[model samples]
Target: MSTAEAGRGPRLVPVRAADGRVGWSLVAANGRRLAAAVRSYRSDRELASGICELLAERAVLRFVLSQREDRLWIWTAHLPARSTRAGAGGGEAVARSARGYLRRDQCRQSVAAFRQGADHVQRLRRLAGGAFPSSAW
Candidate 1:
């Protein structure tokens, strides 16, 4: 088990690559990615959007992730519901739509890069969200 896995707290983190691209990932305490959740973006806004999508709420939606041949794929599934009818089999159903992403898009997250981006975003939020008093503003 990685340190991040053993460590407690938010499993997901935002990271920046050497090329200065930002990405989000689910990392372990050892700082290794749990899966290929890292996908880089040219700007922080794009990265934030991706993060939102990943963290977005789902109603009766469950996503299954799989890896094959150095690539990652996600398939959407929905919870089985009852129609107020008897003999209705309600179980996990596989989705027809499946999407695959390249492995290159998912690199192991670095603690340094993640901390840098996290700090920058948090600092921006504090300043822009009026965390300071009106007099300080």
Candidate 2:
């Protein structure tokens, strides 16, 4: 999964799977809308993490969707600063910067977990053929 800037929004494009299926997600900054599409998932968790990774890179905000032990979290990074507020006190701004970026870390961890889960489910489905239920993920 990778993110590419598209117009005013961000476009997320994923590589086609072995079954010739592609998934995509798009989000506009300023909290406009969220769009997602999924095709074939030979395994339940095939592209779980991928979706999150794409969103994290392009989103200014994200929504998480998961079930039971299988969790999927989504996040968007802040858009580039368009302006700097004057008289905001540079000292305070500097202090805030020292806090580091918690949001970025959260997004990264969520994507990693989702990726791991997807890989596990994919292997299970492949081994079990069509015996595994789609809801198992």
Q: For model 1, state the Cα shift of residue 131 in Å.
A: 12
State the lDDT of candidate 1 residue by residue for 42-114, as single tens digits: 9977765554443232233344435566565433333444465886656333221213445423321222333
lDDT, residue 8, model 1: 39
User: How many steric clashes between backbone atoms does each model show?
Assistant: 7, 2
In the range 1-137, model 2's lDDT, one tens digit per residue, is: 21221122332323356776655433323332233343433443556554433333332223333232334334322223335787543221000010112355554664444343334433444444533323222
Error of 2 at 122 (Å): 0.1
Best by lDDT: 1
> Residue 23 in candidate 2 has what lDDT?
52
User: Model 2: runs farther than 4 Å from truth?
Assistant: 1-102, 134-137
Question: What value of lDDT does candidate 2 attain over all alpha carbons?
Answer: 0.35
Among these predictions, the greatest TM-score belongs to 1
**Model 1 TM-score on a 0 to 1 scale:** 0.36
Where does the lowest 10-residue lDDT sum fall in candidate 1?
128-137
Candidate 2 local lDDT, residue 96:
9
